[model samples]
Target chain A: MERTTIDLWVGVFVAMGIAALLFLALKVGNIGGFEAGSVYTTHANFDNIGGLKAKAPVKSAGVLVGRVTEIRFDNDSYQAEAILSLSSQ
Target chain B: MGVSTRFFFLLLLHSGTCFRRPQLILREIFSSGVLSLIIILVSGLFVGMVLGMQGYETLQTYGSEEALGVLVSLSLVRELGPVVAALLFASRAGSAITAEIGLMKATEQLAAMEMMAVDPLARVVAPRFWGGVISMPLLAAMFSAMGIFGGYLVGVVLIGVDEGSFWSQMQAAVDIREDILNGVIKSTVFGIAVTVIALFEGYDAPPTAEGVSRATTRTVVTSSLAILMLDFVLTAFMFRGV
Candidate 1:
């Protein structure tokens, strides 16, 4: 019984550690954010994404006011087209 | 043949032997899972704390202590966290695996398994190989994230950087795709390398207790060296175009 309780506590601590890690990743990665008043959408083309994923943050002038919503290859140019949603300035 | 060709030949032979037994290897991994988790968690916390302190001090001189968030997060997520976690895991787990297997071999357990038609590679090695593959990335992620938080605590709560600006700088500096992928890829490779080296040393150990001890020591040293070498190669290749 005591062993079981210790195991339970250990499990809880491990879970907390994992949760804290996930939170940090999300915070640093800027996964989800939606501001209240206004938002706009824009697109950019790049020759290579270099492992960029959907929902990766889009930065302009060093602030993360938006995130990438969609990514597709341009048929003609064969480049990545990223659709970004930005909060109004 | 050239020296490189001979080295390549030996590597191929080693890999072939390592892949022989899957199920037995997996069973060993399952048994050792809890111990591995504990080691990872403890080491990760220390790595994060040290990284935060160092990063904060460096950024202070430039009057960009706020950028410590960026520096810590970027460095940990991309490189240091994974490498350090892997090295720790290799030292702790790799040496243990080598010694355990070497002792079994010295005691003729391996020979018994072979005589009974049980493939030792499948039973003894493959599980460990896969365990390292799975565990290293998870551990790396944990280490990197914890390190970032440590930086946040030091940079914001202790050092007086505004919370908002610190977070912003961190968010700005991180290219999620590049950073995360770099860590995951390096750890995966490091895991495989560590497991292979440990298993190799164990299987090749001389037939005595002294031999097992020597093999354990070699496993730790070789795996640690391999982790650093692989980190450099992966960094150069992954970041070349970035």
Candidate 2:
């Protein structure tokens, strides 16, 4: 019974450790790249969207400034227009 | 065929028969899949954290810290995620498999199975082979996801890169198909290579504890080397058109 209890604690500790690690990792890595506040909009037209998805980032000079808030076809130009929201730095 | 040619042919046939049993291979692959997933998730987080820190530091030097998203995404998706996960798997699970089978051989369990009219090849080898095949891509995906998360945490929260800018940069700079596919393809090949080498070494182990230990070490070392070599080959092929 004692050994089983110890084992249970060990499992709990491991689970907590993994969770903590994941939290820290996600906090530090910024993998999802979601941010709050600071919204400015811009547009871009692309011939092929390919795998581009909504909420994808908008980059200028190799730096990320905003995310794509909306995407639609510009019938006049026959191009995909991406509306991006830039953050205030 | 001449006598020499016949002898060579026999050797080839035996070698082929020893390793290429699909059912046995599949079983091994299934087991490897579970093991590989755990390793990949853990390693992916670390890989992402490291990439974020290093990329941030470098970008800061040039007053371009906001490029962290692009750097982390590209590096994780294209290169670091799969390779680091593969290395971790090679060190952890690859060594374990080699040692387990090596010990079995040393204890004559393999011979016992043969004596009992059981095919050790079918029973022992197949599961691990298939396990590796199934596990590798799953592991790679976990690694990629964790890595991206790690970068997000550091780049946005710690450095205060404005959440909007950080994500936007990542989306604009990263070509999802290119980055994600690179990792998947590399991981699949790495899984096969690790499985084959570990299984081969385990089965070929000498009948002693010392021999088993040596085989385990060799499996780890060789699998790591194989991953690196194959990474280069795969990268070359992947980028040839680009």
Instruction: Give the per-residue lDDT digits (tens) of candidate 2, residues B170-195.
Output: 65566544556566778889987787
In model 2, what is the error at residue B146, expressed in angstroms? 1.0
For every model in order, what is the iRMS?
Answer: 5.0, 9.0
Worst 10 residues of 2 chain A by lDDT: A21-30
Clashing pairs in 1: B21-B121, B21-B122, B22-B122, B24-B123, B25-B123, B25-B127, B26-B127
Q: Model 1 over residues B68-98: C-alpha lDDT tens digits? A: 7788888888888789888887887788888
Model 1 stretches with alpha carbons more than 4 Å out: A1-21, A33-64, A67-89, B1-27, B30-33
A3-89: candidate 2 lDDT, tens digit per residue: 445345434433543453343234323345445666777788999887766756667796767777788999999998888788777
Model 2, runs deviating above 4 Å: A1-89, B1-39, B240-242
> How much lDDT does each candidate structure score?
0.72, 0.70
* For model 2 chain B, the run of ten residues with the poorest summed lDDT: B4-13
Listed in order, the DockQ scores are: 0.22, 0.06
Alpha-carbon DockQ of candidate 2: 0.06
Candidate 2, CAPRI quality class derived from DockQ: incorrect
RMSD in angstroms between candidate 2 and the native structure over all alpha carbons: 9.2
